[model samples]
Target: MTQQDRRRIAAGLADGLSYAEIARRLDRPTSTISREIGRNGGPSGYRPQQAHQATAQRARRGTPAPPRAAVPAEGTREAEGAREESAREAEVIEMAVRAGLPRMTARVHLDLLLSEEGRRTAAELARRLKVSPASVSVAVNYLVDQGYVRRERDPRRRRDIYVVDDDAWYHSIMIGSRQTLEAARSSIEAAQAAGLDRPVGRRMARAGAFLERVSLDMMESADRWRSLLA
Candidate 1:
């Protein structure tokens, strides 16, 4: 994080914006913002200048900076590092929750996402998340139903493992775009049925056309960029 990023974080906190919203504005992950604040005196006490100076001091002392990508929660070198890592992950879970996922669902997804295999059995998930097996079951079931996750049977283990693949985002985006396009089609058909020559019908027709264009544009852009996930 830069001095400017710290300033924005401070400003975001002052304005009562959630870490997730601030992350969106800064184009950084919510975890990054979370760690930055956690190491620097926290929300009510954050001062950008002090945080910058402290970071500079760390650089001078050869202390490594946190990685932008998520890190494993276990095996951190120091207690402080572990705390920061946990805080970062907590922020990510909060962001997921804000995006409409239930808390345990978000936690389960984050755990699988951070794992080396991009997958986990219910036993492992329950163990790591410290939640009941039932909780993991409910959360993973919900995710699978929403098409945000998938389950595969582990032949060797004789159990099911939930996997969050790279294509999760791409698939979700396409599903959303398809739904919007369907809506656009329905609106356009209705407008036609009502006679586009009429004033209200003309308005509806124009709106539907706009929706159609935007939906198609979104689908095209998503497909073009989907390769980045690989």
Candidate 2:
């Protein structure tokens, strides 16, 4: 879609127009509008110019089509289906990038999540993303450190598969909770050391209290929502 189209959609949303209404005004199919907005972060987070730029970047990174081989009718249909999925995957990668993930990191994360087993070896991820294995290694390592991914050794293959599963979020949230608790501890200690009578100490104490509460709430929410995610 064009920048003008995006702007119109944003305007329509601000004016409280329904998706069908926006589609009608744009002279585009309703599905097109819905998909476009969804790909760009939905109504709440959509940025017209950023979406346009992300699309352009994807076009620039486009790989050449592989030569067609002789195949049965069903195989040809499957190939076509793969192409459609690739298009959707490209949209999702762009959206993830706009949501603050680095492009390559987003690509790797999506590939692992989409895989049948929710995992891929570094070599496999690199091959799929058309990047070096070292690049994939870096991305996966970062993800592992952040608890968004994990590694499991495949004994036969003698290689590790980067994985994303329900446990990934659990690990990530728990890691975040620990960090928040640490922050709370340090800030409160600083407040005490600096003297609570001082303005800075009082401010730090308040901040620490807030972080402590937030950490507790995060742990509670994770426990509450864990079953659903599982």
Candidate 3:
């Protein structure tokens, strides 16, 4: 996180923005912002400088000394190479958020993407993100419902783990295309039934036409992409 990000979080808190809103402005996951504040005295006692210093100390402990010529990237990267990979993960999560995903949902997707074992138990996610199991449960459930993730029983551990695969985006796009097509149909019907003249009707008709074409195009494109990956 950057100093600017910390300051923004403090400002957001003062302005009574929700954690999700703060994460959106910072281009970070809500769990990340929540955990940061929770660990640093739960908002009331939180100080940006102290939080930054504490994060630096933790990074120093986990990271080796950096070469003199190397400057860390955006304060997200530390002396260790792992931090660089983490920074990249954060970038992916932010991109997902900007694509209209909820912050916690995006974070869960990132956690699954970065897991070495290809899956993670809910308990592990909650613990790592410093969130309640209920929060993880809700996020994972939403992802599962949206076909972005799957839950499977881990017989060895006697627990369930969430799994994500390379085809996840394909599923998301296909579903979105279908929904867009449905909405376009409804819009066209509403516009026609209103009995409005050409001016207003023409505008709605054009929008519906555009949506119709794009929806079909998205489905076809997704199919082609899936074929290549297959």
Candidate 4:
């Protein structure tokens, strides 16, 4: 849909129109409206500008369309959307890899993130991603060690579910910041042993001070957000 369409949908929501009503007004399907709102933060939190920007970012990074012969007939918007979504998952994997995630780990993490449930068993993930269970196991183990995923048990099914969420973000940030701060401090100490008055020592000291301040600020922000969420 066009940006104008999204704006109209937002306006319609503001006016208290239901998803079905909005779809009727726009001659689209209710699922389209519902999916749009859900992805953009649901009806209560939906913001047209943010949604538009997110949509644009996804579009810019979208995967190339498959060959004509491989595609279904025209007018199958839902099917087409599903195919595009699977293609988009590849882009997510690529972006993760560029960000230093291992290839298999990236795929597994992206799969979990893109999943509707936001959680999956190793076997389920491996099946869905077309990889071996052993591969998924190794990837998830690495992800857990890196603070990217959490392991949980399904009481009803007796299977482990790997989850990724705000906790992962908070933990990863705190861990990385602490490590950086420690390394910077060590550099400063090493430089000081030589001579604090020297240019190299001054540079190291300054770098350490900057990183220390940044780490403190990040930790403070993370704590504030945690309390707010709590």
Name the lDDT of candidate 4. Answer: 0.75
In model 4, which runs have C-alpha deviations exceeding 4 angstroms? Answer: 1-75, 153-159, 227-230
Error of 2 at 100 (Å): 3.5
Evaluated at residue 77, the lDDT of candidate 2 is 75
* Residue 153 accuracy (lDDT) in model 4: 90
Flag the better candidate by lDDT, 2 or 4.
Answer: 2
Q: Give stretches of model 1 more than 4 Å off.
A: 1-77, 193-207
Tell me how candidate 2 scores on lDDT.
Answer: 0.78
Local accuracy of candidate 4 as per-residue lDDT tens digits, 183-214: 87887797797688899888888888888889
User: Please, what is the TM-score per model?
Assistant: 0.58, 0.62, 0.66, 0.60
Cα lDDT of model 1 by residue, 46-136, tens digit: 8999999999998999985545345655455664575556667777866776688876798788888899989889999877655678988
List ranges where model 2 is wrong by over 4 Å. Answer: 1-91
Which number leads on lDDT? Answer: 1
The 10 consecutive residues of candidate 2 with the worst lDDT sum are 63-72
lDDT of 2 at 114: 91
Candidate 3 off by > 4 Å:
1-9, 12-78, 154-159, 196-198
